[model samples]
Target: MPHSHQNRIQAPQLAAVVVACIALFTDMLVYGILIPLLPLMPAVSRSGPAATGLLFAAYAGMMIIVTPLAGRFVDRRGPRGPLLAALLGLGMACLLFAVGGPYWLLLVSRLLQGAAAGLGWVASLALIAAAIPLPKRGTYLGIAMSMVSLGTLAGPPLAGWLAREYGHAAPFVFATVVLLIDGALRIAFVRPVPPQADDPATALDVLRVKGAWPVVILIAVGSGVTSMIEPILPVQLHEALGLDSVQIGLLFGLLVIVAATLNPLVGAALGRCSPRFLVFCGVLLAMAGLLLLGGGARHAPVIAGVVILGAAIAFLVAPASTLIGVVGARTSPPALGGAYSLYNLAYAAGLV
Candidate 1:
């Protein structure tokens, strides 16, 4: 009877984890799907590099503004409502991208996508924390993070291939289908999990937790440094190595593949190791990789640098997220949503 009872309890938790992972995966997949196609946009092609940069910036900028507000909403309400809204927003964004139009439409699509990303990430992470037990949260979060990396790894190449064979609209069409499926899953499987009874912490209150600032800083710096690579690396690879779009996609995919493979190990380590220590090591690794990349005019060196940086990101992301979740639960359980919001906001700021 006890075993059966335990199984019943575990079932909902498992379902919640699955739903959260899918939501995050869908969000990242759509984000990455656009990377290869961005340059091909009519406006971008005509306007040159500056326009491309602006489109990317628009997404990150919106995320920075909306994330904290989304977090507060999640804390006050629950993850279910915010998550559903995010999914709807993502669908709209994908539709706009598929329709393809004036430069303004592209910008609007990106902005909406950014808002969805901000809300989706915070709500999904908060839901995971609510569903899973603290001791096991790191492992599950790691798995979910891996889904994110995998989405990034798969998206560009898949989109590139689809665009090459079918048309520009193909990837967006597929994304819309995937989003619909994700919405159906959420509607069916996700339930409203209430916040803890403790008073909800304001953004300021959440940031006041001991050890929060350092992690927030690390999140920002790590995100900022890595964000620099996406825009710069493709151009560099094209100019220096004469790589085509497919090759560039492959290279970017390889980096995320390494990160996806290592994230679970890093997640497992969170249970046993000091989160701060892991973060410090990750920073050193990223620095080393950056130094190596500076010397990477050649292929071998570039691949090595990318692999090292991928591992570094894996180390930083999972541990930092686990630490934040643990800290929120301890300091003010109802504030977990706000805490994740701040973390993501820092990440967006880094991109800006």
Candidate 2:
């Protein structure tokens, strides 16, 4: 468990965590919403799927490449700067989408958005880890993580409805408004409480921890394997089992919701007991879920797989994050952000 001079939850830190949740939700929601439309953008304009795919690829690829540097910056400066930058960049990306800009401009916007998101996402976790006590960290992180489900739950249907009712640009405008508001809240209130004596180290430091590199490899492989499953599972089910799209969405959505629901419980268990053991178990759970997912036995089997995977993710992700915080506090405070950045990078690299 990570010990801080701070005891219990402070008001500002709580507020920051809430704001961070909102920010993460909005950013992720925008990404989710944009993904469905990326291929469509070319059809709407002179550019085609190839061009739009380039833009999407640029965003994702650039984000991966830049994450380590972004993590280092957040480690040095704390969350405020990166958090604000993320909001601003997201807002600009929304505006660019709204404008239906030239391909080059769109590509630039995506790169900016990705870099900003990487920074904010890592920094927000670092801030929360710093703010919350070790015992309560999992529960709080679970709560924060749930907000991700909330955004995802809302984003797809909301975007569809807006596009149906108000036209294509409506979703972008709506997301932009949300981003702006989220940014304002973060900037107005989410300053880091104080600088702590976290260690300053380059990415190489992550390699020095005896068992840490294995965790990274596990996360990367897990993320890569899961990433392919996540976006296509519902569609694959709909086609394979003749289920309705809504049902597929529900099943897929439930996976995240379940993960969010379980995170705190799993975290609390780790807090009370052995974190490393839980992490290992969590990884095994994920692998088991993957095996189930691969079976494609029946609708029930697939749903079961999704649920198990969700539970596995909840168990693994929250505790792993908390463990990183623990390591950071022990080694140096600033490394918290860097640790998370490397984690994110490993996940992203796996996706690629």
Candidate 3:
């Protein structure tokens, strides 16, 4: 790297990367911590499938309302302020679960958490786009994705062990502490970068841009395919395929591992290619996975489908964010925030 380029990269930017990675990790960890424990929830286990589905919906419902607003807040106020506030909210939300609060409390915490999550994710992405040069953005995004993948991969086993040894609440406590620490580090190390967009108010206007809609469609479909697996896998494996929890865990773990390992390489490759091509290939791969999943085959087929899906995610997510960044470059900071917020909304919606 040239001296000027090296000089442009400061400790704060590096810290922003670390903070974003850790924030992503903690977010995934907190969310996945409940997976092993959810079956233990009285409502989930005893209630009918319809009721249980409602409970799940209740938890995720807030994301729908909070994401776009978070982006606007980041655009107007900058990342450092909102990021810290969001992290603190996440920490408190996790702590609420740790104390074994009532279902109502959990519901409230989840809603608050959805807002925090939207802001945290948007802020982190915005920070990355502002701190890193465009040419290197894909690689950084890949690294960020892998960090999140690693967290999701690691969270289950850790939470499972905690639940088994200590109790369900133990994992929540751990998540709270991790999030707090992450927040503190972010506060200490990260500085707000100048806004990247020209106008937040008009950023949504870009939705009319002929090219942007394809990216949105791509995000929605890709996210939906990924979301489908989480709900179906355990039942399909246990009921249809006759695998035990241990086996299911191993297979799922492998998917995260593979995805994490591949994401950076995929991102670097994306840097060398057009975002559109990479995203298209990602969709094709995910579609293949979905086909295998719905085909109702044995364990091998299931695992194959999962691997493909993970690979598709590894390919698609960073490029999608990159596309948003590209689109926002012509707009104002608030518009940039709106664009990212829209991306998060698409992602969260897809997950639903």
Candidate 4:
């Protein structure tokens, strides 16, 4: 399009995007990587359902507690310290996964990982918001989302394969090594962004900002709409179509693949389209998908619903996020961090 827009991704901005992508990818990667490997572990399997459930709670609970605080921290101090913490937290969690045997150790690892994930998401988004031109942030954020989708799509099967080929520790070892590279890139490419907030002291202050609540609600509903389906889609397919676990997993993978493929394109469209219009279209699509998801008794319709919903989510998430970034950036950079912290909380709430 415009030469000015093309020139937006200068070295620091490019590095910002790169590090953000890797940070998000690693955060999500750690999340997905353990999915298959954990159940296969004798200790984990023997731990029973209560303990297994607690394992997930460890991460999600910590994420919920830390997200808003991390947002405030990033806004005040900039993304530098939070980014470093992400690296260290993720690294240590991976190390524990690789070597530590007891359930307590694994539980602690999840806690560390959950906290790190909160830091990574807030810091990385703030980093890009600060580094990239406002006009281009949507597109770059979409690219980061695409990387996150890759981590989600790849993590389960990759870990399963690695564990099968080598041992239970293989996937964790690989993740630890990936974190090392992530560390190097962080040191080399992460530029410090000065704090920009003038009045907002906490994420709560973000509520006082005009035009912020709608974006926050949109993020939560848009994310929740898709996420709430994750557990249901598999079960619905199984009961209605008699699909096996493998087939259901693959069907769900289609949802991830569709969203992953479309997110960047949707993100780019934000530069040219009204964020409001894009979000409206996304809502319409989501409604249609929900109908199909609810009405369908046949396999084809359900599968189609999954694909459509995936695209609907891509459309919904990108524009809303871009708008929120705009809102956060209206005055100072700290607001941006606060906004994304709200984003993380909203996303986490959706997961719950």
State each candidate's clash count: 0, 4, 9, 0
Across 63-143, the per-residue lDDT of candidate 1 in tens digits comes to: 887777877787778789989999999999999998776778888998999999988987898788778655465568667
Instruction: Give the per-residue lDDT digits (tens) of candidate 2, residues 19-40.
Output: 8788878877887665444444
| Candidate 4 Cα lDDT to native | 0.74
lDDT of 3 by residue, 190-298 (tens): 7867765434343366565557777777677766665556545655666688764445556667767766677667657876898778888887998897788778568
> Across residues 1-352, which tens digit of lDDT does each residue of candidate 4 receive?
6878664577777878898899898888888776545543456556765566677657767888878787778767888899999899999999888874688888888899988988888888778777765556557866776788888877756665676678778888999888899989888888678743342444565655788788778787776786555435544555678764445546656777887777768879988988788888888888988899988899878888888988888888877767776676663434554666666777776555
What are the Cα lDDT values of the candidates? 0.79, 0.67, 0.69, 0.74
Measured by TM-score, how close is model 3 to the native structure?
0.79
Residue ranges of candidate 4 with Cα displaced over 4 Å: 1-9, 39-41, 47-51, 99-101, 196-206, 209-215, 222-252, 262-312, 315-319, 322-337
lDDT of model 4 at position 26: 84
Pairs clashing in candidate 1? none
Off by over 4 Å in 2: 1-13, 35-57, 75-78, 98-109, 126-146, 164-166, 190-194, 198-203, 230-251, 265-305, 315-319, 329-335
* Model 1 stretches astray by more than 4 angstroms: 1-10, 40-42, 99-101, 130-139, 198-203, 264-281, 291-298, 329-338
Candidates in order: C-alpha RMSD to true structure: 3.4, 5.1, 4.0, 5.1
Ranking by TM-score: 1, 3, 4, 2
How much does candidate 4 score in TM-score?
A: 0.73
Best by TM-score: 1
Q: Lowest summed lDDT over 10 consecutive residues: which window, candidate 4? A: 195-204
